[model samples]
Target: MDVLAVEVLRIPMAVDLAAIVIGALTGGLLAAREGFAVSGVLLLAVSGGLGGGLIRDVLLDVPVVALTNPVYLPTVGITAMVTFFFSGWLSRTTGLLVGLDALTLGFFTVIGAQKAQLAGLPVTSVVFIGVATAVGGAVIRDVLLAQRADIVQPGPYNAVAALIGASLLAVLAGPLELPLLPVAAVVIALTAGLRLVSVLRGWSAPVAID
Candidate 1:
């Protein structure tokens, strides 16, 4: 039987949307800690939630999911408000924010890769879009917060993890013709796990040599 004889591994669109909400929650928490007002919180949250996918859609020449999906806007908006109000409790949890951030990184990387592939993009473009989408929101968030983007800073393996995940997608789902859901799950686990370990252990990606 052909690959189509079995059901493919596409994750439901609704489940994938949790990634945007998680990103927005992180942004809202950051805004709260920064003493940003309601407007500022909303701005950062929206940027973090939708920025990466916006870039992906624009580059792919597709409709922006944030604008097109009714649930996207409202869900992210509510996530920001919740994070803004309950930031104290959220922060008190052990590594909760960082975990969520890493999780979103994994989700974005795989999602971007899958979307690009569905668009008939090249492997290189798929990886690029995947990595860009994973880190784009954090770049925007840090810029708005007046700090250097963490991905650019000599910090943990944020982009590196995304790179690994995207490349894995290129290999496993693209050429190998494996099930996308399992491939996506593996990508998310490795990407997020690598990120979490790097953060917890203070493992820095190699910096530019002098």
Candidate 2:
């Protein structure tokens, strides 16, 4: 692989790890609030934390992290333990969980875009992969819990925020040739901030009132 490809791969792995951590924490809190047992919490943590990456990798024809990487297992395990140990503290602050979820969404979106670019996918395809990466886990989680997926629901532009972030990364990658870490950080920050603002302000996509 070329130097740029090597650099892209390394940074996205780090970002994926960070996303897993955030997902595990958020999933743990949700599971605790739902009165899940320790096993259930751990299950949710693993599923929610790594589900998207699994889907993304499979779609991209790469090895799935949950099956191939030891790091993913321990990361989710640690997150579950921390949440179980501090259940009381986290159960009281639901907002923090939502914020972390948003951050994870942003992180995964960028990773998907970066990976798509490395895989030689078109820009539009890369953007689609990014959206799938950001929302796939939540979709799986909700299905397991028998709840609606937030990304598809009429909420404050969750998937749209991810699309924007992925597009930004792809655009930046094309011209400026910014390093993956800095580009990923900027994309994640902007996307998360946009989602937070939308949540706070009750923003939503326009609807026709025929």
Candidate 3:
């Protein structure tokens, strides 16, 4: 129960590293589809997996754990290797990765909000960081692949779900002052539920008129 900030909850390092693996899974799948070599897979994995935290730390002006931590790079590397090998099977197993992405969405969100809380940011900024942490990696992946950021275009409720999760955390952790683990649980469940339902029901964010 090592605390990082006054009254702010610090999630376990294992959980934090797990989010990186899940995010990198998405990148690894994409690289496999493109027939990239092992090195390229590792690159996209780092970008898609670790980029968000990098962005968050930079904004916070704190040390970058992705680069600094001894365990982080290896975690991403192993994930990329596994994903590259299993890309075929994983692609065939429809909804598996999607479910994982949905499930872990809250992890990144809560961690981002937690970091912002450590920095004493206001609620709005906290929510912003949360969503950024959840989806910033994907945006970087798309950019590196020479495509548009899927989030900017019409898509499902990925960011919206993250927003809801981060906002809930802001409310519970800010005004209500609830316990950290319970609040994080609620946020994660709600965000994942929203995302999963949206995907299953084919819900998409509204776009401008044609």
Cα lDDT tens digits, model 3, 1-210, are: 135643333577677777788888888888998999888899889977798888888887888878878888889999999888998987786578788888778788888888887678998999999998888888888888889888887777988999999999998988788988899999998999888998999899888888
lDDT per residue, candidate 2, 1-210, as tens digits?
Answer: 476446556765776687898888877778887999999889788777887777888998877757877788998999999998898987787787778778888888887787778888888888988888888877777888998777667779788899899989988885567777788889989999988889889999556589
Q: Return the TM-score for candidate 2, rounded to 2 decimals.
A: 0.86
Q: What clash count does candidate 1 reach? A: 0
lDDT of 3: 0.85
**Residue 147: error of model 1 in Å?**
2.1
TM-score for each of the candidates: 0.91, 0.86, 0.91
Tell me how many residue pairs clash in candidate 2: 0
Question: In candidate 2, which residue pairs get closer than 3 Å at backbone N, Cα or C atoms, i.e. clash?
Answer: none
Residue 179 shift from truth in candidate 1, angstroms: 2.1
Cα deviation at 16, candidate 2, in Å, is: 4.0
Steric overlap count per candidate: 0, 0, 0
Off by over 4 Å in 1: 1-9
Q: What's the CA RMSD for each of the models?
A: 3.5, 2.6, 2.3
